[model samples]
Target: MKSQIRVVWALMWSRAAVLRSDPERGEITTTVIVTALMAIAAIAIIGIIVAKLTQKANSIDLG
Candidate 1:
């Protein structure tokens, strides 16, 4: 049983190492960064639109 456990542990460790060295990892990081930037840009655009609309609304003479 102990030998079986050791073999399983070794296999898991090797798999982890293989995953850690994968070249595709950078693609995921790049994708996440791009998505975050796009989200931030969208929020900024919405804020600008809201501000402009609010300014326009306040300028209407209600008197």
Candidate 2:
């Protein structure tokens, strides 16, 4: 059982090394940047909507 565990670990290590050396890793960076930009845009849009709603609410005459 111990030998089997060692073999499994070795295989996993080698696979990780191969992935680390891959040339296409930049794709992950691009995906992260795009996701961050989208998140920022969504936050900005929600902020603008909330500001407009608050302004309209405060403009009402309570007297």
> What's the TM-score of every candidate structure?
0.74, 0.63
Q: Please provide, for model 1 over 1-63, each residue's C-alpha lDDT reduced to its tens digit, 9 standing for 90 to 100.
A: 999999999999999999999988679889999999999999999999999999999999999
Please count the clashing residue pairs in each candidate, in the order shown.
0, 0
- Report, for every candidate in turn, its global Cα lDDT versus the true structure: 0.97, 0.98
Off by over 4 Å in 2: 1-23
Q: Model 1 residue 49 lDDT? A: 100
Q: After superposition, how far is residue 13 of candidate 1 from its true place, in Å?
A: 2.5
- Screening candidate 1 with a backbone cut-off below 3 angstroms (N, C-alpha, C), the clashing residue pairs are none
- Give the C-alpha lDDT of model 1: 0.97
C-alpha lDDT of candidate 2 relative to the true structure: 0.98
Best by TM-score: 1
Worst 10 residues of 2 by lDDT: 20-29
lDDT of 2 by residue, 20-43 (tens): 999997798899999999999999
